[model samples]
Target: MSERIPVFKPYIGVDTAKAAVDALDLGWLGMGSYVRDFEARLGSVLGVEGERVVAVNTGTSALHLAMLSLGIGPGDEVITPSFNNIGDFQAIRQAGAEPVFCDIDEETLGIDVEKAEALISPRTKALIGMDYAGIPCRLDALQEMAARHQLKVIHDAAHALGSRLHGRSMAAYGDITIFSFDPVKIITSIDGGALVVETATQVEALHRYRLLGMDQSARRMYTNERAWTYDVADRGFRYHLANLHASIGLSQLELLSAFIETRRDACRRYAALLAGVEGLRLPATDFTDVAPFIYYVRIAGGRRDDVIRSLSEAGIDTGIHWIPGHNFTLLKTCRRGDLSVTERVGREILTMPLHSFMPAST
Candidate 1:
């Protein structure tokens, strides 16, 4: 009999279901002890203090709140890679800032600092970077670039939960770091994200930002007290992560190291098995310290469509990581320059089936 494979699957088991039920039975389903515990464990993983991490319900919300707390507004720009999910650009536009699409290094497919330097204008307030598939972004170069420009670094680490660079977790490399726990990602809290803000001022701002600009008053209400006082320092959103979601996160965190190793082993095995496959160029990965989020390969000579058709016919589901933000309709009216690499790579990238599902073959 022939075996089937899945594109993306998480390792949520019986324990996860039990934990969720228990949390819900407690009747405190909002951001409470479970959320706090998850944040604490997550902070420990990032090598940060417990107070540094603020858990939210989605990665986009994390980015939106981070931008609000970072004080990014209209007329400001945040430099990011042109080849990325539209959501990144959407978050920038949502924050009332312009996302300056920068070119990426072809080999690692990460944001290129040199191109970012050229795009830097007086209004460039922050640098947002993504790992592109659990591979750490060129942090040393990116940090230097942000330092020279005096701009803050906010990492969109949706695909880099278990990744590190130069022996340091990716979270430590940015002034602000955001991670996603969506079902398809490295781990899932069903759907969650977190913002890491180390400073007191940023934390205070973030508190208000996530709870709809009602920082202190909201906290008092939760404690059954009437603090009929509030101020909207700035426009914010309802971005808090629920306690039930955090319970699932806590259960998953207990198994992240093992989860990372499983992904690494799968990636290595896939590389070994397909190394001899002709006409396919595997993604360039940083094996030193990174998790394998998704295994992508390039199909050369215009065979991408053909290869995909063949795979789909065999019941295999696949996907493209992104469509190159520079090519989007939103940027069509803007004066966008040549992002030749992004335009070229967008057509060739294809993520394969390598999640934590498919049973081992004999």
Candidate 2:
């Protein structure tokens, strides 16, 4: 049998394994020097200050913390695209806020700023715009609309860590930007996430919220030491990233530029190979300015399932980026704008195998 190709794979190396083992041997285990080092290096990569970044246990936790730190809660409504990941919706609910689904732009697959603005009302406290497959949303437009309504903007850059918009890093634009380093993401920490905020107040709030609302000094913890006494002034969750995960992340971070280049090359190759196929809509972009997380194509005439089956038989795995949030039982009644584009795209989209350092045969 021919080897099966996975739809997603991490680009881990021997160095990455060694880094994790070395961290384990340090015996400090939990959030420590390695985590701090990772955050600093990540911030440097994003061109943000060290003080503006916070590392957490998962991408979901990053979203939850972003919502909480922004003071979004019961009676508040957050506008988000119905085409987004379920994690974005759950994060709003986790903060006791309602999610108002909006449609997506057919081109970028990101939020439609105009449609999202139409969903805003007196109760709207924030807007969550997610980058689709590393394609950035109209963040400038979203920010402008949010500014008019005095609403906060949370950028879900989970798929866009290495992506740049008009030559500026994705992290350089949004009010609060979050990134994921899960096992299958562009980079893996085993599993981890980060948030980049603007102000010192927001930074301090995120630190507190990710550590059980304790007023413990992060500076002290970064050195692998903890203060004996601390105060709890608000509710928080156990979301801090550990040294082991951070160690792996640090190792991955060192090769992020190369990983991005490799993925982009694979995506370009896919585009070249699959171009001109009738009834298929290839990704709109040329894979420049974006660090693609997945290479997906839209199959027309209801042949998506058949294509998946045929690919499976050939030892090639495939995936679906998501099922529309509104289709889920829990989100059925959520207020939403017209989701015509989102619904159609959801049904037709099929993720193809693409990995960093992907073999030419694949």
Candidate 3:
């Protein structure tokens, strides 16, 4: 490597800070017009005609809205991968549903479609497929399974803002797709996320659910602004992003194409650099339109910790993307059956720094 790398780097600029500054000076720091504009702009990126996308404060809220809108409440089981971030689990629980754990396949580092099948029960309501490190999930296969099981599909696209599969965005396939705009993503909205949903019913439900569940429309209020006469139709939260976050998001979204290209180039270079390294595995590319969001390499022979320690000592901080969600103390009691592969893969995986900020080197 030409230069030292950190665990993660946020792709950002002065323009983003200026946008937030302008919002601060204005005084209206609540969610309003900016969020709507961001939503409209983001919806356009879906590459799907008439795609209805909604922007929320965080990715968690987006998933929560997806579950809530689908009426997935207590006793409903949402089959999900235990190989990635646990944010989706909280969203499921918040929607009063249980998140059923499914193991990942070592070959693709994605949820084993067959393993997912075994976990399905009569109470299964939905399936949330996580696009681990920008690799688009096998949506076609998963969708087929979802349809057969009568379950809606939600995509945790937190690391897949600009990722694609077969020229289609992940959001284009899932019933509800959530994109996180956190600092370390390909693009940064400072701190924000968007939920690409379908149908007016789902959009309206998301809007209300994120904005206090209040009928704040002027038509429903005696005054020009929202009045005290409001109803909490569903369990809602103040998950609406401020104008500042939206402003920054707008700038970042415009720069997404370039960022994505850079990330792809980096992944190709990384894969080539370590092409013949033994005891290491490069990411699989079953999907043609693969768009990488992280620089991860799986260390075989259980030397993942050694690599991380070595990288850290060399000023190249590395990270393990996640631990199995079921391993968490909170969910330990709920874990059923054996999860050996999921347990081992959880430790063997390591992520190197990847973003658009680093200078291109030959």
Q: Tell me the whole-model lDDT of each prediction, alpha carbons only.
A: 0.81, 0.92, 0.76
Sort by TM-score, top down from the best:
2, 1, 3
Deviation (Å) of 132 in candidate 3: 0.6
TM-score of each: 0.93, 0.99, 0.92
In candidate 3, what are the lDDT values of residues 1-362, reduced to their tens digit? 45677767776578777777876786656675566667778877777433377777877777788888888999999888877677888988988899888887776577777878888889999988888888876778888999998888887888777677777777777787888887777777777878777687777777778777876652232121345667777666888787788878888888888777777777777887888999988788632365567878888898887888887778787777888888898776556555677887787788877777455662
Q: What is the lDDT of residue 261 in candidate 3?
A: 77
**Model 2 Cα displacement at 276 (Å)?**
0.8
CA lDDT, candidate 2, residue 157:
98
Best-fitting candidate, measured by lDDT? 2
On residues 42-74, what C-alpha lDDT tens digit does candidate 2 reach at each position?
999999887889999999999999988888999
Q: What residue runs in model 2 are displaced by over 4 Å at the alpha carbon?
A: none
**Per-residue alpha-carbon lDDT of model 1 for 1-362, expressed as tens digits?**
35556688888799899889988897887767787788889999988887888888999989888787788989999888888777778888998999888878877788887877888889999988888888777878898989988998988888998788878887888888999999888789999999988797787777777777775643443332444666677767888788889899999888888788877877877788878688878767635477878988877788999988998888787888888876778875332455777777888889988665434451
The order by descending lDDT is 2, 1, 3
**Model 3 vs. true fold: TM:** 0.92
Q: Is candidate 1 or candidate 3 better by TM-score?
A: 1
Rate residue 206 of model 3 by lDDT. Answer: 74
RMSD of 2: 0.8
Q: Candidate 2: lDDT of 150? A: 91
